[model samples]
Target: MRKYGRTDEASSALAVQLRSYPANERTHYKHAVHQHFSHRNEPLTKEDITQALCQLNGQKGGNKS
Candidate 1:
């Protein structure tokens, strides 16, 4: 099971969309969920989102033997 939250069509679509973006413009799961619910009053900025993206993206590829 996915650790982040529930797995649904909307979240799957957003994950695909977010993965398509360059790491510089990637969105965070938390922030994405917040925005999805129109939580504009959340205490977070665009920079934080991008940072989370970079961090997660950085783990995408590796040789596991």
Candidate 2:
């Protein structure tokens, strides 16, 4: 079964999305997540959401082979 914690859910979805894209695109996504989460107390923009998704994808991949 998939372990679905609040943080896990976000990263899991990001990983699936990353599998659909090329390597270079993943970097942009990672940067966005880092920027947004780093300043999470502030408002998130559309770009921030996009970035978070990217970051999640990369993080998920790192956990696997």
Candidate 3:
């Protein structure tokens, strides 16, 4: 979180997210997301996701694949 200047407010949302994805894919996504967000100067923390979730509620997400 510090890398992107984000702070933790809740539990790890990424941890919960990993539950549904396959192990290998989840691992790759973690690395990919960290690098991607790092490059974009965004965040990938619980607070970030939490806030994003609120803002994105009921909205369909675009595919990143």
Candidate 4:
């Protein structure tokens, strides 16, 4: 199962849309979830989102055979 909290059609569509963004522009999963809900007051800045994704991508790939 996907680790992210959401699994609805709109979330799925957003995931697809996010894929088209360059890695630098891609928002982190946490931020995406936060933005999805209206309760949060201060959204993350663009730099923070980019940094989060960059850090995530920096980890070693786990697809070894």
Candidate 5:
């Protein structure tokens, strides 16, 4: 709740994605995600994901207040 903002879905997409990983790879992927989000001071909101995707595609997201 703190790291990622409220999701509209009934279940977490992140959990579903993680579960798709092979059993041997789950631990490694989980640890990597934790390490990445743990350092972020602000919660990861939908807007954050959108911005990330935009940046990934080499486009800049509009500024937010």
Candidate 6:
């Protein structure tokens, strides 16, 4: 079983996505990607995901602050 930072529905979805990765790469990938994004230094809130998606689609997210 995999461990996640939170147990809410959104966190569950993230866990499911992580689980889809190959077993050999799962832990390291999750630790590196998720931990970096979710760390307090950057603080990945739900808003960050939305902002990222917008940026990916060529739309600019409003000011970071």
Identify the leading candidate in terms of lDDT.
Answer: 2
Instruction: Write candidate 1's Cα lDDT for 33-61 as tens digits.
Output: 54444533434344444554455555554
The per-candidate count of clashes, in order, stands at 0, 1, 0, 0, 0, 0
- Cα lDDT tens digits, model 3, 1-65, are 46744445323575676567668666655554454455545445675554444333334345434
The full ranking of all candidates by TM-score, starting with the best, is: 3, 5, 2, 6, 4, 1
Which stretches of model 5 miss by more than 4 angstroms? 1-11, 45-65
Error of 5 at 21 (Å): 0.7
- Candidate 1: give its CA RMSD in angstroms: 10.8
Number of the predicted model whose TM-score against the real structure is largest: 3
- lDDT of every predicted structure (CA atoms): 0.50, 0.56, 0.51, 0.49, 0.48, 0.48
Better of 2 and 3 by lDDT: 2
The candidate with the higher TM-score, 4 or 6, is 6
> Which lDDT tens digits does candidate 4 get at residues 1-65?
23333346545555565686677655665464444443434443444445544454455344345
lDDT of 2 by residue, 1-65 (tens): 22222254456555566666789777676455555566344444445456667457568676453
Worst window of 10 by summed lDDT in candidate 1: 36-45
Summarize candidate 6's per-residue lDDT along 1-65 as a digit string, tens digits.
23434336545554565566569855654455454455444334455444434343343336465
Candidate 1 matches the true fold with a TM-score of 0.33
Q: Kindly report which residue pairs in candidate 5 clash with one another.
A: none
- Pull out the clashing pairs in model 3: none
Q: Is candidate 5 or candidate 6 better by TM-score?
A: 5
lDDT of 4 at 6: 39
lDDT of 4: 0.49
